[model samples]
Target chain A: MTTNHNRLTIHEAHKLLKSKELSSVELTKATLERIHNLEPKVHAFTTITDELALRQAQKADEFIAAGNSNPLTGIPVLVKDNMCTKGILTTCSSKMLENFVPPYDATVVERLNGRGAVIIGKSNMDEFAMGSSTENSALFTTHNPWELSRVPGGSSGGSAAAVAAGEAIYALGSDTGGSIRQPAGFCSVTGLKPTYGRVSRYGLVAFASSLDQIGPLTQDVTDCALVLNAIAGYDTRDSTSAPQPTPDYTQCLTADIKGLKIGVPKEYFVEGIQPEVAAAIRAAITRLEELGASIEWEVSLAHTPYALAVYYIIAPSEASANLARYDGVKYGFSYSDTKNMWQAMEKTREHGFGAEVKRRIMLGTYALSAGYYDAWYLKAQKVRTLIRREFDQAFTKYDALITPTSPTVPFKIGEKMDDPLQMYLSDVCTIPVNIAGLPAISIPAGFADGLPIGMQIIGKPFAEETILKIAYAFQQATDWHMRKPNI
Target chain B: MKLSREEVLHITRLARLGLTEAEVDRLSEQLSNILEHFEVLQQADTTDVPPTAQSIDLLNVLKGDEVAASLPQSQVLVNAPRREGDFFRVRAVLE
Candidate 1:
């Protein structure tokens, strides 16, 4: 088996599988071997499904032998721990649910399994998907594959890091607030946070129900599109899933960018953005312009500064309520016999939750409390409306908005763990898109001082095709996404 | 920004978790640090801005009040750490 450490692009692997050059079992085994060798150092996975993965890979090979080949057939993909997989210990990196084994698969997992995609493992994440850095993860922190000392941004850090390290060809991640994109930027991979409701969220342990979205993190934009096709669609099980027609995302990858209107949001280029990151973003815009896409400076969103505050309030507020179900009575880790129900519940939660998780829950509870509801939660929702409206007006004139995915390059782990406020600002660029519930993608823009940076493409709701098209064009023009970290 | 240990305890109780005194002291500092970041929003003139609740302009998605089959109670409680018959076993709430 070839164990060449260079990352395999999903498209290349698919072609090889089709041509009989490589079997699904071979690929799955290779990836598992890589995980065994690298995972201890990378800390990308919380639980690696070695037995289940090999079993699924054998099944995928049987399908291929029987002449049944699909886009994801025989491909191995990692899933964020938050997405439930039947009989798998799907801990969202929280001690609270450390022993929880879900009885059913998250909608995406079901879809991937049906398509014969081998489930590699569950990636680690910030507990309840709350922090900018994976340092908040309860199980263990996932180090950036490019630089072990730096963080793979979170809360989807594990997914991003795993893909970056070639542990899997592609992976699934959730974005509540830049959880997918920021980590992708940090790990130098392609990750998309589709328009809210583009994919079903059933069985995904809720973080912020309204803001949480599941999308793909892949080596390139094309694989991101393929994964999106496999996972996205309407599901009656998820009430918020849009009943819109799913597009063939691969068809949108045409190199023709003539007359495409790409809007560069000036607000994104404000001070505090590192000079190198700013230069890379500008170069991306220049590359797009050279490819026949018309670039225009636009003032689309002015309420971006409020996105973090509003997100902290609303996400936690919803989380506080949603997490109430895990009070020692449900399917999570529970306490032993105690004097009173209250004491048991208290002990279970206190021992289960990490410091960050507890802090967010408390903040959220306070925001939604009777006296504070009007001032915090309600007010935040109203501000979210304005943020959405700003994008709605912009999409009328522009095909997509482009910006830096993160303000700076990946920072060293534990650098900002003590300063909670500084950590929140790490997702500044990616949060507004989540606030607006729009389709957005992060593609490796360029490198800065040996570290990678990512550029974000935001599109109107249901305009996933347009966003993918822009990212595809940029990926073709630049080889940034192809640069594997020399770990 | 400053948060008293009392304030941290109050919030922790509201969140339905018990905190140790040491945890409370640490959280007071952490919460205060985070709230200081919230100061950025204060400069924004949001007086007339209506708070946006959801990103999509979605109306209530209602389904007919029809019976939908649920998982068997046995299956649901199969993983419960403590269970009694069809109910999840728990410490008694009151005398």
Candidate 2:
């Protein structure tokens, strides 16, 4: 008895539920059925909660029946597996925590539950959110919904794929360097990576605590706004969270950008971008200009070339420290074959972590070592200040900046897996935003060779409203965000 | 930019990860390539700039000192790979 509820966005479903034309239970059932059918081809979810979703759906029905309907009350959602779900397996798609279930909910999870968002399952990710392609997952690889042979972008590939496949209404993903936006770009969905401290990261599995941020992946800009409204707020648990009042994100979606000043950095449009991807972004820029938003093409983010290098040094350096807790005791996997505890810990890590995770740990350890500290880690941090300053200066003249989310469209699976350096370049365009701790959103620009190309709108620190308004205008004038994959 | 075999082994020791001989050889080449990428930071001329450990400016967030509810002991130890009487059991530290 699945209905036409699978493709409804949060805004569309809200009106239907409020008018007593639909129940949350029906929407949940259809979404669960879609997951059951498409999961074999998409491989999006690591775990599917059928019983819990049904129970939550019934409660959402009750809440709506009592006339307390909010934007998210009946919406079925998916969260990346990195977020701790109480009593659910929260593996980061690594063998290290394959069976580890958390005892508490992440702050984002708690906030969503409070708003009556029905979480259907946890999505797959790169091991410890380390790589650019979902192939880094030790358990399984998530294929793009558009092309079953191609990859969904990493590390939040599963969440992006799920939303693109209509397996969920909206989903949440974490971005360290473009985990959310890159995958959403590849899968042709909308995703936002809020300003560095916009959301609390309390129960999130740490990859690089300083850079990691949690955000939403949705079907449209409207749904993205609703999901952001539910999840963005401050919490005392995370010291890095900025103590600021969150404006209603959905309130800004009504107005269009008429006289908005958008900056286009010349450095981002370099030689590496695929010709088709470049063409689509150019057309999108033209469309924005036609819609009355002025675009400046001479902005220079001079330090763009150093972002990837700095990220590699600093992210892995923080990873080496954040990942130190996975020793063979207290939780997760442990090796007990050896009698000595120290050797056992070593063996457990050797057997538990995947190659990508191990490579990062080793690289980090060497960079922070005695002779290399001043040359690598500390120098990278100083260069990070430079990159941040570039964005800070650009925002003074522009309301928002536009750039391609990734250099190229999504490639086939296993194409870049063998070359780690090539894989590292997948995040080249998106990493600088994380370094600057600014807000950005990726929306579907158009298709390139039948694959999606994403264009990002970046705003100043804590200025999520401006970017969302600009993106909403572009999305209204274009139908790119309406296209769904056939999976 | 090249990581030697001895150096790879030493770094693994510091990281407390035991890699087989084949794993060491492969990681040395890969880690060397990765390090060569980081060498560009030397050209950045960050002579007078300060290091940024965290991006946000807020710090020293202190919660109230009053006692709050903690996780139950049963839930905390539920996922332990090996447990004995509410304590995690691991291989002996000393011989």
| Strongest candidate by lDDT | 2
Candidate 2 chain A worst ten-residue window by lDDT = A1-10
Q: TM-score for all predictions?
A: 0.97, 0.98
Question: What is the C-alpha lDDT profile of model 1 across A161-265, one tens digit per residue?
Answer: 999989888999999999999999999999999999999999899999999999999999889999999999999899899988898999999978889998998
Which runs in model 1 stand beyond 4 Å of their true positions?
A298-300, B39-50, B64-69
Model 2 agreement with the true structure over B11-48: per-residue lDDT tens digits: 99999988989999999999998888878888898988
Cα lDDT over the full model 2: 0.91
Whole-model lDDT per candidate: 0.88, 0.91
**DockQ per candidate, 2 decimals:** 0.67, 0.83
lDDT for position A293 in model 1: 94
lDDT at B49 for candidate 1? 72
Predicted chain A of model 2: TM-score relative to the true chain A?
0.99
